[model samples]
Target: MKLSFYLHKNGAKYAMLTSIGGCISILGYLIYILNPLQLILDKLLTFQPGSLIFKLWTQPPYEVLAKIYIFNVTNSEQFLAGKEKLNLTQTGPYVYQEIVHNSEAIFNENGTLTYKPIRELKFRPELSVEDPDKARIIGPNIPLLGISSYMKNEYGLFMNLGFSSVVNMVKSPSLTNLSVTEYLFGYEDPLVELASTYVPSWIDFTKFGILDRLMSIDNGNTITMHLSTNTTSKDDILYQYSVDIFNGSPGLKQWGYREDIPEENSPCNTVEGAFESGVFPRHLKENTTVRLYRKAFCRSTSMIYENTDYTSSGMKYYNYRIDQNFLSTSEENPENKCFCKNSKKCLPKGFGSLDPCYYGIPIAMSQPHYLNADPEIRKQVIGMNPDQEKHDTVMKLSPELGIPIYARLRMQINLNVSPDQIVTSSKPFQGMILPLFWVELGIYDMPSYLGILINIAAQIPTIEMVTSYILGMIGALMIATVGVCVIRGFNQNRSDVESENQGLESSPFLSIPVQPIIRSEFKLLR
Candidate 1:
């Protein structure tokens, strides 16, 4: 109303000025109230595919544990060997000796007249010695692609087509500075893609006891170290595996129990083959450490399933990133609900959540310290599985230390439907996305494309009322000033009329009217 009045009174100029003032004040007040310090925290929150915010939230006190094992793990490749040579011996006049046959000599240095390849050398990968990425040093007997024989025979280049590197173990007691990953098998850029990047050296020999003894290696135990950074979050589901390794191959042998995590399955921590013990040699008893830190950060309010087909969901989906703390509690009773609960690991009551991906004993990412191949002893140890069929599980499984955590577990959330999606806590998602994408972008990470909807729901229009009111107040004050001037003018005019009337009625300056007064008085008296 005041604004309208001002326009009529020619006070419209104040509107924009007052509005700008109001906006400034509003902006300041809103920022002051947010208190951003309260909202930021550190948790293991992964980037869920379908959400921009509110992702899988884990419980508090998830303890991260490390089991240090001292063992020697050797692969199929030989570091250094005696040379094969041709020699002549004297007996009678001309001692009978083996003829010059190149193919006959395989390993020994003393032969008849033929010198074979000296010794059939095991495969090794070519690698970059200079450390580029600041990561934990790698160890020996780890799995990786070896230099191919064809490439070595052709261009005289090392057989490794970027599939090897030297694991630098200066401080670590594992292997020496040997080449492990040089380049990807067929990759153009080694830095960007993960498939091009080779696995660490410790993945080669993953068994314990006779497994290493039978292969002629000293020790060949395998254990995975889960990091506190991201082991217990709502986003990632951790698992372990055993594999088979080629005796003469460069990297660690394949899984000694299972190749990889199984397809559409759960964790198998209770199972025996999931882990091994004493894989290292008796001569070297120092433990090797591998560390896996958090890499990608993302979040959402919803929990993403490893198996569910989220491509068709019509709901507004979510993804998020949140900094979380460790949440590990002791669950000693195997019969209770929290029986499987413990620090550094967990296995809930509902097991089906890990569909499309196998869940098993947790595995560890390689530490930078344990990298490098040693020039010391013996043979390589491989996985023991004789089955011809391949497994569908992809998660790695191991069972040495920490908790061999295989059991039924519950989902982060609980849902019921034709195909139900459940959520237990929102703690998994905080800080996963931006306000604009959650409220303005209108697109969800999920296929449903409902991010914009959530953004709109959280939005509010900027009101101009404060500015308008301020402008109206100023205009009204100006009009009041004009009214005061008009009222003063009327009072002045009335005062002047009153003064003129007093003069007219004052009898013409009675003193100067002496003669007229005498005449007037006489006429009155007569």
Candidate 2:
């Protein structure tokens, strides 16, 4: 009975260990299958044909203005239009609503996808600064187009106008007569539109031919953007609209990831691919440089660098830059008739110099905060903090998810002025790149699915760690208990043997038994 009990006890312990180990094995397998990377890939690849993720990602989200800062510079030593202008800075809030008129998407035979895009724009004149009209016209002269408001209106641009007028203007405003109505309200010339004139005509949203130009490059609407569907190398996808004007091929890969993130063969340009692959060569902490395509200025390559990294809402990101010096040179983009036609000088890095088509009036572009730009850029422009924290065109993203978390696409519109017969007023100005205003498109609060994805990524590792630790501790405790029980059983058996030997040695019968047995044996023999 005792042996049976011992066997049972040992057997029970062995069974318990086996059961615990089995549970751990099952859990580990589950965790691996549900790993964050696999989960994200599953969702993206297995999307039912018209799912929300499909629509949102393929269409992308719209952005709104969070704030606006105008930079005005003055020379105590010089004057324009015979005015000793006071250098000043103006800041305020702006609002607008984007309207998507039509959109469509289709899967392609090349394992790619295409989308057709149609959108419209509207601005809220109310809930804005007063002198809404004068405030609208700030910037350097675009000749027949306009100038920065600071240069246009010597007085102040802020009127702190009430909301009623703005509401009425937008409530029944005629789309056909936008220019006239806005002009009458002193809101006709938006600073962004002024900035757009300086951008290459192909990428200029303000131009009516934007759609045609985009389609002409590849014979597909801007909405028909080609996207890679292969998930193996999430980093290898390139999504920017191609600039195929010179190549005469299907849209040339002009924008988006130009080279591999780590110089690997994997894709790295598509927004989706980057998220899936976590391969942002530009995101390297080592300050690596990358080349990307730009659709606006005749499909050109931009040399940029990962300057730093940041985090928000549990997501990680890297900051990259297209500073003036880096942008001023690119063999990929030859000087074209539309821009750089005159001096054939590469446009200054930050400023857009597509003045050839705009009546020889040079329009320049820069960042809102002018981060990483020429020192002279901020020096001439007041009200600019020039802090990288505020002004950089930052692309905040998650390294793990390879998706953009938040983005601040910022740029300033400036006009280059010089003494010439075309404009006698600019003669006294010398050669100066005068800033008109800067705007930022702040896109944040990622779609719900993306947030879910990030959370899962964060949670999976935690679950694995916690579960492993707890299971490990339990397993260690069980092993220790079994070992102690085994040691105690061995000690108990040894003690039992010793006690039995002592009892046998202390028996009184055994002391006298030897002599008695000898006498009895002799009598029996007789």
Best candidate per TM-score, number?
Answer: 2
Quote the lDDT for 343 in model 2.
Answer: 43
Tens-place lDDT digits, model 2, residues 314-368: 5445555543453332343232222332343554445555343232334555665
lDDT agreement of model 1 with the native: 0.22
TM-score of each: 0.24, 0.60
What's the true lDDT of residue 176 in model 2? 16
Per-residue lDDT tens digits for candidate 1, residues 1-526, read: 4333434554344445445555555544543454222222111111122222212111111111111111222321232121221111111111111111112212222210111211111221122223322212222211111111112222332423232232121111112222112210111222212322343332222222111111222112222321212334332222221111112221221111233533312221212112121111111111212112110000001111122111132222122111111111124322222223221223222111111111111212111111111111001112111111121111111111121111111111111011110111111211111000000001112222223332222221122334444555555555555566456655766777788788887865654857888999999999
